[model samples]
Target: MKPRFYDLSMPLSEKTAPFPLDTPFSRVETMRMEDGDACNVTVITMSVHVGTHVDAPYHYDEQGLRIDEVALERYIGKANVFTVYPREVDGIPIITADDVRELSISAERVLLHTETYPEYAAFHANFASIEPDAIDVLAERGVRLIGVDVPSVDKATSKTLPAHKRCREREILILENLRLEHVPDGDYELIALPLRIAGGDASPVRAVLRMYAETKDMT
Candidate 1:
């Protein structure tokens, strides 16, 4: 039997919590089946960066690529899930180059699994973040995508986000707000798909992974 795929996204709802200070996600009914409507439908109005989402280069760079401008291959490929338990990675103090060097990263998609699960399920303060140095390392290494388990890559209080800038400048895709507790650090086939919103800076993504089984034929 083939292994099952695990979903790594938070449920979106009217009661669903978003990052601190961000507007709460809302779903309003544009057409309802209960009101003798032909179909049940609703229009969603919320920040693209609200939940599990991907940030295009245009998120930070004015001249960078938008959500629709990105290629399909950027979101799907072999990815590495690296787990990190940083007590505090807010502000300038965050995932460093040395921390990244320790991980055996060879995949184009580097998904960082910070053990900040459950704790970040609801509204909370201070999610684990990535430092500029780590971003520098990723950019230099030709990493195509950088994903994390938290909302933003930098601290919530950051005014100038060098980490976002580094990746944006290099055209590296950004995937955030993933549930990485169930996934371990290893090689896997990553499938992260984002909405093709025209000129959108970001879009929520449904991220998952497919674990490969060892084949006896390899020997």
Candidate 2:
């Protein structure tokens, strides 16, 4: 059967909330059609990690691949959405190795949908994050892509940045600040395309998911 599709990416804008350390998102007017120009055009500039985005291996590894080096298939495929939120309200929860194991996700791509959704559109300093051990589990499971609904895989104030390192070492792609309130845990086709930024550590993404059913073995 044809599956239903849902966009799981956060909207980008100068007004959107951003990380404390990074500069606030900014888009100044370079050209305005209101000035009697031929067309209405505006120059845009912002941090690569500003809105819904992906983290390349280069984000943490010195010899990792850059945003432009990422392949199309890496961000688009059948993925499993796992919800490990342990809070009553949608908040960042610590994901452990056991949690990864319980999800039974052996696919190349995995999307983590935290409980923060449906009405959560603002950024929070503390949100769900994966433990370093959880990163190991994903690497061991041969997961090539990992996504979440927060700004960074590491805590907002992480000292070691272990989560980013582990994923980078394993060549796992990281998609962050996703809008997964409209989605649930299940098997789905994920189409998350990142900007082709040359030698960039990360880039914004336009992510979408298509729902599907698993058929019995034909072999």
Estimate candidate 2's alpha-carbon lDDT, on a 0 to 1 scale. Answer: 0.77
Off by over 4 Å in 2: 1-3, 86-92, 116-122, 213-219
Give the TM-score of each candidate.
0.88, 0.87
Query: Every model's Cα RMSD, please?
Result: 3.3, 3.7
Clashing pairs in 2: 92-127, 92-128, 93-128
Alpha-carbon error at 144 in model 2, in Å?
1.3
lDDT of 1 by residue, 61-161 (tens): 88888898899888887888888756453233357777886777778889998765455447654566777777778777768899888878877677787
| Per-residue alpha-carbon lDDT of candidate 2 for residues 49-92, written as tens digits (9 for 90 to 100) | 87788888887877888889888888877888887753322544
**Number of the top TM-score candidate:** 1
- How high is the CA lDDT of each candidate model? 0.77, 0.77
Superposition error at 78 for model 1 (Å): 0.4
